[model samples]
Target: MRAGRKYFIYDVFTQRPLDGNPLAVVIDSEGLDTAAMQAIAREFNLSETAFVLPPKNPTHKACVRIFTPDYEMPFAGHPTVGTAIALSEMAEGNDLAGIFVLEENIGLVRCAIDKLNNGLFAEFDVPQLPEQLPLSADPEAIGAALGLGPHEIGFENHRVSLWSAGVPYIAVPVADLKAAAKVKLNNDAWVEFSPRKSEFAVASAYVYGRETVDHTSSFHARMIVPGNPSYEDPATGSAAAAFAGAIMRFDQPTDGSHRFWIEQGIEMGRPSRIRLEIDVAGGKLAAARIGGHAVRVAEGVLLA
Candidate 1:
């Protein structure tokens, strides 16, 4: 039998274990090709898995490859948070903090790590700011896909919108937490209406409401990926990144730094909280950041 490579599992976007999104990180993964890495991610069967490879430029920390079971991702929020924490913990002990750069597929991601009493928190500047994409489908159609009616579709001025930072998401604004809880994403209906940008296909659904289960959270949210293996995500950073555009469009925050905590994954029992920070300049999105806490819950040898 071949000796296995080292791997770790982290609970991301929450201080406690078994509460947040679980990410599998394979550390000793230099020689493995894309196909093998995809197979390992499928084996772990989490929302996403990260493989750490040596950085092409020696100054950077490492190269991280993120993947869902079905396909590779250019970038993702939880993986960036989890991987940053994992790398920080590996490089420095619990007492010290770190700031480093990770080479992600989208681009070089700048991440900052802080060691706190609850857990280790890591935040990264989103390489790309959110941009709106044209969505032709009306509110009624979008609501139908999420098992909501016209009345339950929107709250305040918020309505259906499509946005993307790197990955695409259709932000469906619902009435309340009650409406958010009732979401049952229909894959066939979703794919039929999902807006495509450029040459890619399949933009996932991100449902949000003003009312939240946690008083600290600014929004209660849910993300559903619709495809051959359609499933709900516990906490989605990328979706939140895309939703930033929708927030800017409707809320119209002034030119300053703002932070909002988004609570997600409650429907799946793996509750998570993601922190989104945006800097507004001249009434436009200047920069944005996604941050969260992570804890290493398990470690093992990956046997082939």
Candidate 2:
């Protein structure tokens, strides 16, 4: 038998185990190259995977690489939260409250870790703020792709828009939770109309509504990653960060620090809540952060 590497499974964006987005964190990723990491990610078959390596700069904590089942990403939210918490829990000292920098392709991301009563929590400021992209696709066409009609497409002052923080997403607003629940993504139509995020990829659809199952939640959302076999993300922090652009453009929150909880993954049964905090100054987004609770669900050795 070969000496295996250590790995952890964490449910992110929720406090409970098996209720949030699941992540695989490969801790002993010193010599694993890009191809090996991608293969490991495919093996886990989760939304995203994180590989931890020794930092090039000793001042920083580690260099974390993020990979989706399909390809490598510049940055991702759940993986950042999950990896930070996983590393903090592994630290030798009990004092876990502090900030550490994780080097990523996007840039150096500063993550703050805190110890909660139930589980550890982590939050990271988005390396790049949201930027609105041009979308020529008609609203009705967008609706049809999601198995929605024009009548149920949007609510007051909300419309289809394209935005990206690190990853791009098509922000689609629906009438209510009922419309959100009715969404069944047609991958073919989505590929036809969505903007290209890369040579081999297009933007994913982010469906949202004001109605939420949790009373404390400000909105309900679902993330649909467009592929041959279309799939839905239960809780997406990157989508929430991108959605902040749509919220600021429409709702126009007062200038200051604002906190909003978005509930997602209900229809899929893995319910999750993502915390979005935006600092508004002069009627513009000065900064933003994505935060969530992560619980270590399983730990084992990866034979690969």
Candidate 3:
């Protein structure tokens, strides 16, 4: 067991504790091997756990390794936000507002931190521009995997689309919030629809609708990764990042900076809110950003 390793627990995308997705961050993971880190992630049993290490580049604040119980991710949203806030809080004599760069598997991500009335807020520019993938599964197959009827699968011009910013997800637009809330993944169907050897192995289904719990929100969403420790994630930043491609494709927003508020995790009782900002110029996506609040819940040392 590696003794004296510190960690913090944070509820991400929400101001209050235990309301949003929970993240466990090992403050300094310099000596831990990959297997040890994976063991720590499983021990935490959260949707994702982060290991913070000194940056390889002097200009970056830190390098973060994100892990689900099953695999290491190139990047993840909440962990990035939570880790930044945690680091900022730890820095002595630092102003509340500043920019920090973090190195992740995808690339270097720049995060801006601000102290809001609710809590510390962190927002980061998407490290990679979301791109549409040629891969797609049948609507029927997708519906079956999600326990939805074919009729409820898509809405308006939106259909099933595969997109990735850093991580990939199947963006599924449903008819309404009610339909979005009722989603259940059938493991067998999902395996059949998205085979293990296929590209969808790393992809999860992200269902969303225009209707939202908060009137100020632009969309309501839910994500289900069938075999993960947390089958349904309360909030998914990566999915929201990929969703920018879907928005540009279906909504066709005019040239300008557009802000979208997304409500997610209501069905699981862990309601979370995510802010997505997209900048367009010359009818092309110039950049995108994801932001939200996080509150520290607990802190402890890992005996192992």
Write model 3 residue lDDT over 190-243, tens digit each, in one string.
Answer: 765552422325468889998788899999999988663328899999999999
Estimate, for each residue in 27-79, the C-alpha lDDT of model 2 and write its tens digit: 97998889889988999999899999999899998999999988999888999
Error of 2 at 137 (Å): 0.1
In terms of lDDT, the best-performing candidate is: 2
Better of 2 and 3 by TM-score: 2
Candidates in order have lDDT scores of 0.90, 0.91, 0.88
Q: Show model 1 residue runs off by greater than 4 Å.
A: 92-95, 196-201
Cα RMSD (angstroms) for every candidate in the order listed: 1.8, 1.3, 1.8
TM-score for predicted model 1 compared with the true structure? 0.96
Candidate 2, 237: how far from true, in Å?
Answer: 1.1
The window of 10 residues in a row where model 3 has the poorest summed lDDT is 193-202
Supply the TM-score for candidate 2: 0.97
Name the runs in model 2 displaced over 4 angstroms.
Answer: none
Residue pairs whose backbone atoms clash in candidate 1? none
Q: Model 2 RMSD to the real structure?
A: 1.3
